[model samples]
Target chain A: MDRGKISKWLKYPEKMGHKYSLWAIYFATGCGIMEIPPVLTSRWDAERFGVLPAATPRQANLFLITGYVSVKTLRPIVRTYELMREPKYTVGFGSCPINGGMYWDSYNTIKRVDKYIPIDGWIAGCMPRPESIFIAVTKLWMMIDKGAATGYIRYRENYRYYRENQERILGKLDWPPLYPEKMGEDNG
Target chain B: MDERELELFFGPQHMGMVGNFSITLKVRGDRVVEARANPGYLHRGFAKMMEYRVWIQNFPLVCRINVMDPDPYELIYAMGVEELAGIEVPERAKYIRTIVMELSRLASHLAWIWAYGNALGFDTIGQWSMGDRDYIIDLLEFLTGGRIYHIYIWPGGVRRDLPDGFEEKTLKILDTLEGHLPEYDDVFFNNRLFVTRARGVAKITKEEAIELGATGQVLRATGVKMDIRKLEPYAAYPYLDFEIPVREDGDSYSRMMLIREEMDQSISIIRQCFKKMPKGPVYHRVPNPFKWKVPKGETYVRMESARGELGLYMVSTGEDKPYRVHFRPPSLPHGILILEKLLKGASIADVGHIMMSLYIAAPEVDR
Candidate 1:
């Protein structure tokens, strides 16, 4: 009916091609394969935005750095970021990604997700409201349209400051204590 | 033909996951051959951190363990130390604690509703649930400055006295929420799709659940009728009367229903607490936050959290800091061992759903 409508119809088939980007996501960086449902669901779906996971360093344009990252997780996070193609964007879902919202000072939780990966958006809640998540996606979309999606470059340039000397933003988080049973190895 | 297994790790950042945890799945064709949970992402060395901060500082810190229902942590720790130090909580302080605790319960269960809906791929349910949950958080923020982590309940008593007309405002909010319950049921709790997806999934018998260390809804869902509040009434719970909802089937569906019904019970408790609350000083006169030293003693206090029985084992050395603070988090048995066992033959899609229903707090587990 209109030029924009014609363009939308033309892009629909091409957009469908992005669903396969999930496998590329797996091949690109294997963070948590189990958490792929929300990443692939009908709503909050990653494929519709053309910002899907890439299999290798060359195929990826955007990195959906969803969920929390810790020291144990920091290794894969760093490796995956390193493997992504240039001019990529990183989005941290929930407060776990930024300032370790719920898990602040645990030996394992990285105080700030921005320590390892360059975050384009930091959703405030512990597990962010999906509306905030959708807002983040829109922000990322705007960044893409503006051709300024490379948070990785800025991260690399300021790497030393964020990595070595950044003050832990939310210091000494106030939370309930979680203590594992002492490792006695005395099971008979 | 090949002995070498292809290892596929899921989560620690994946979308289908409940939180920051990984599942190493060995998949042969479409079925999972073996699965193991790797949880350490949100670990913040809670016990170690507790050892560093003073007793009062730990009140705000402990609430972070399980962000959903934080009132229990503050209440239990304060009560435990108060018992050890022999401090008498004022009558008004006790009633205020009960009001706050029940409000925390309402918010916690509401958040659980969002997670449950999201897990089953029902996004609208999640949206509605979260919007409704925000009302509870709003009410909480009105009482306490912070939304998710309300560092309100302190040793001796609450942090501040009830704001002018706080009870009236809270009751009004509860009235609004009561009207919205049937709509939530239509969309989530009794939704046919959710009912189908959750029914019979992870079915455990009562005896099996007891042996598995299942507490809270997991125990109640199996028709166990076990609740820590009833068994050990700490803080102001001894004064409040409430019913523990139980279900015959211990499946994921039954557990979801049990939690939903529990929210109603929590609301009722809040209403009762408000009706009977006496007006007086909100906080008892305790030593200041920074330089306070607790008597040397070990107190094991357990409270019913949104998940289950959360036991805080505080070992004090009569110093400004705790000698050792060990948390017997309810989520561990369910999130780790219980989840691994139940997920053995289930589809990979249902993993996050089951975990959400279990309501694992990554910080709680890691601490």
Candidate 2:
């Protein structure tokens, strides 16, 4: 019971909507996806925490980067991340996403996930238990309350910097830019 | 006649498709005209990676091949190694492996039900099936330390013996699952809407199904009585008595029905394992991981996984690490050939429904 969030909840119902109804776009990457069914099912019951899988990225605010991101997968990942609405949060769900985990030396997989996507939190394990996902979600709620979970905002503010880094690896990205820096107009 | 052709990139991210893979669908109006599969998004090239790791280190890597049903991949890989090394799994270890495999089959079927129901816009059954699958995953967590990837089945035998009072707990979970069958029948299996949507949606002939290299439930549903468990007995399958559920409809409904009945069969098999299990050592220690070198030989071991026949082809050249490791996933033909052919005349609404009904675990395709 953080007093700040409690007070803010009363003041801003908008924040309450973001806190309670966090729709996660299940942008599955690798093996860690096995844990999601159990989490969403009756046993783990992630719905109890108001987290559900959104079919499309446009409707979701929480992007769950489930496992290792290979060089090829980062293209869709960035596109999906950009499609997500503002006040968004991203969580890297397994050890693979945090630091490439077992695939550290694998030529295709990216060793550091944070370099490309602005991840608000990480659940570290070869594959973290379903319960650990709940913990990450609660921490995300706290960050949202404090207005600290600003990965989306950060993505918008420094689109050029992030875009350059993304383009460094993924040359001539297929999709149009999420925010055009050349227009000199703040999309944020 | 007025319908226009639309080139749709039914890529990896869509709800209907399985895993991190894509399908390039050419559709005119609601029906698909031509389809091409774009796979390997989840491809870490695990086979090449296996060559670099030692025999024991590769055990965990095999499970990553099929995310939905990792047990059979681990089992087949272990069986391949066991055959290549001339290692014998003990009686108790074989029984334990059988029990774990059957439990995995149950969980995998439940997941298939969840996917199928969700694909057909029946979220109620999806939630229910997922709830039931969790019960099986809980038992898995109890047996192996890990929930998703057990990595328990190794060359010589299993990792360890069953934990204390594991049998009794397993019985209770089975009882609970048995109780939930009627509710599933009402909401999903026997539900009129599901039957209407699934039946005749993606029908395949028996000859083409076999010709196209489809196996497991997909092949079985096409009226072909082919099951690796029945035809080729491995592990404790010879001792255990279970019937393979086959349906002749060769449509989405038949496949769905076989999956439901197979879950019941898996449950029955687990009960049989519990009744017939014997007490003995679960493992026979091999030489140190680094020093253990398999004899020079090539072996092909195939096991019936949740989807179908999961085969592993291993080439060991008297080396500490395998020279070549190849996986024959049941989902390959089901995903690419069967799925693409099945999708050609299927309405756009049935794209995901038909694919889910086929039960192609996409990770296996890429791996």
Candidate 3:
């Protein structure tokens, strides 16, 4: 709606569309989910920022992993990531996913979430406030505008490394690889 | 024609499911023939981790056990450690703890209303209740410096005393919440759609509820007058006079109504705490955290959490760390045993509805 950004919007129409409407799939992994309702509801009203909760992963572009990812949950996290359509964004919402937060010492939780799945941004706090989500969203817009937020592209390029890291913890994921086993190859 | 049965997996991902929990259902047509709860997705192994941390260090770790209602875990842990160390909480601290716990209950019940409303296809009610719940979260943030994880209550006493004008702010928020109750009734509780959806669904008898270890609103809704606050009084509960609201019908509607009425009771209890609190220090300083050693003893402490009877059984072996720490979260029974039983013969659509009515926090079941 800003008159000044009209020229910029006209120049990069597809980028502007993706930047504005971010349908989020909030994967409630831990304690950080407590802040999500407030952010989505009337208090913070994430709709104003064009961030809304999508019903399913296939429908969503923004994947907000909203807490600590335990060993058991990591498989589902990986699966959900694979299921989402390309040009997707993933934001680790709390301190847990960044570096395991308080569950760093615990045996079950994975330390660094980036080892398993690519993260576009991280809003770091024990439990980040609802306002922090908005800040993350705006920052994501900037990243998308600059062509910097290419986590989906990164995942595709380095699928083997990410898959190997996931297998190290999860022990042989039941599903096959999203991309080919080898890069730049026709498997047929 | 032969009968056919199909296996269905309900969430850790589905929209209707609660948190990172799933249930395997055997369905014949729309009706569930058998249900099995699959928890442990949220388990951080708190019981195992507590063995490594010192007495005071465990305080912060315990609250994350139940995310929706964290205060009761704090209260129970503090009570367990206080019992083991034989530390007496000040009279003022007792009153403050009571007020904080009740406010937590109100916040949790409001959240339940939000979830319940949403599960039952009442998005308007969900938005209204969640918006209102933020005011209570703000008050908690002001008191404890954290919204979700308060980490306020400890072994000796609370982390801090009530700030100036705190009581007035709390009362004003309570007034606002109380005023909205009637509107909630109009849109949510008294609405014909809610009644039609909730009534006679997941109905349980008084004997069935008692037999299956169903506590909190589940038992109360079944006409059993059992409240840990009343039955085994803790903190300032003995001094305060509040009724345990009960209902004859053990259906989902009755359970929902019990939660609504208990919010009223929580408000009254908080008001009474403000009136009766005496002037004194909030905390009695304990020994140094690093060198502090609790005498060899084991104690079981239980309290009325927002969900149900949250009990902690702690064993100290004259060491800085606990020998073993066990939390008897009410959700363990409600989510697994009671939930599985209720799901049987239930329509596939009402699975989330019944689960929410039972107030099953998945973390509590696994933690």
Candidate 4:
């Protein structure tokens, strides 16, 4: 959060014509979690884009599952999606969350997270370049600004398995520290 | 003294681990009595993956085995297939390959620097080092559209030639980096606080390091002048002039210093390769990836990676895909015996420090 970068970002909102403030982004699943740093940093600066990753479900409306989501992680992803208030959005990065790109055949990884949750935007690539991620962010911002039906609200209608099998999916294998925890947990 | 000592598991899920791997340590109070390195946490079956894909297809996948420094995998696999096919890469491509490889070395060293600095509670240096590494990654992306896994180095040569003004751009970046090195030195290298924490933390004699099969920085840290770059000149290394960096401290501080020195050497190597680079085709057309079949032969190529000596041994059964491919990762020695010994008498907080100093990359260990 350098002062120079912050000032530049401050000017981008009015120039880009965005309406949302205090937008919250989430990384519930995938290798895209690796990109969370730069994605949140001043360059990509999700905040300046008017979308900040919220620390809690009570504060967020956007869930950006940037990479792959294994079955073990799907439960948490589903839970996080459900906890967010209405008018929520979801963006999937890389082919992983959409169709399990390289690990499609793996028994552990889910083929299409979309099948489980509604997706607002899809950035395609084995692992989408950071630039593509940026594009996806802009697309997501436009969709949100328009007040369109982006992410799903009915958890029972979609991701029934995720809702039903929470313990089995999320509880298995003691998720690594790198795995995102429920909001308020110290990630470090 | 009573019956025994305290035991602690360093990871598979522990914060101390470099990636997903872990180690179990047995300690008598602060002094370690026994230690064992345990791997295989995030093993994606890389060996089996190689068996399923064609020789060319395996290039990208193989690089993941050592994500920190992937160019060696590119060079190793390329050298093996080139040997099998009896093909000689163009002179210019060879120099280009060396330049890219050395740049990869610099990137890898930067990553280690970041992790090591963070491990010692020096978070600012880690951030600074990582931000600097982004510049190298940007340059790599410019050269070969791919950043992390540059599958550009194929069987015969690179996928494409240096882009327009690639040399000038690279030289400019190098100059910028040269200017920044003094600042980095003031913060991490010459900083008194870092020196105290890292000094005498993990030590091994030259004989012990050799006996334990240490290589690269760990081996060099033990006063061994063994570097794959010096012993085996792959690509255009024969034409380049560089020295293998060695240190006598045999401790974590020395290992850290070794990488710092190595970064300078890598910069020098890249500069030499750029100057001596001849003009010619950047790539020699190889048989189509779909129709390619290597001659029945076995070849082993080793490269001095940021982690250590990464060796790729390929056995071709006269098929499009390799019959057998074995990766001898340096993490094995560093991860196992050397790391196990280093943990002795150190606090649990220093677990990550010991691992970083030894340069035990997890994928390399699992692969």
Chain B TM-score for the candidates in order: 0.95, 0.98, 0.99, 0.96
Weakest ten-residue segment in model 2 chain A by summed lDDT: A179-188
Q: State the lDDT at A129 in candidate 3.
A: 83
- How much of the true contact map at the interface does candidate 2 reproduce, as a fraction? 0.51
Give the clash count for model 3: 0
Candidate 3, overall lDDT? Answer: 0.90
For model 4, residues B1-76, the per-residue Cα lDDT tens digits are 6746877766543334445565788877666677787765444556666877898888877765666777888888
Winning candidate number (TM-score): 3
What is the per-residue lDDT of model 1 for residues A55-90, given as tens digits with 9 covering 90 to 100? 454566556555456566566566566656555567
Ranked by lDDT, top first: 3, 2, 4, 1
Residue-level lDDT of model 3, residues A5-63, one tens digit each, is: 99998899989999999999856777787888888888888899999888789988999
Candidate 4 CAPRI level: incorrect
Candidate 2 on B67-160: residue-level lDDT in tens? 7888888889889988998888899898999999999988888888887777777888877888888878889989998878889888888998
TM-score, one value per model = 0.77, 0.95, 0.98, 0.78
What is candidate 3's CA lDDT for residue B114? 88
lDDT of 1 by residue, B56-118 (tens): 778867776655567788787887778767788887888888878777777767766766776
Better of 1 and 2 by lDDT: 2
lDDT of each residue in A73-136, candidate 2, tens digit only? 8988988888788878999988888888877767778878778879899899977888899999
Candidate 1: TM of chain A?
Answer: 0.61
* Ranked candidates (DockQ, high to low): 3, 2, 1, 4
Please report the candidate that would top lDDT against the real structure. 3
lDDT of 2 at B314: 91
How does the DockQ of candidate 3 come out? 0.71
Sorted on TM-score, highest at the top, how do the candidates line up?
A: 3, 2, 4, 1
lDDT of each: 0.69, 0.85, 0.90, 0.73
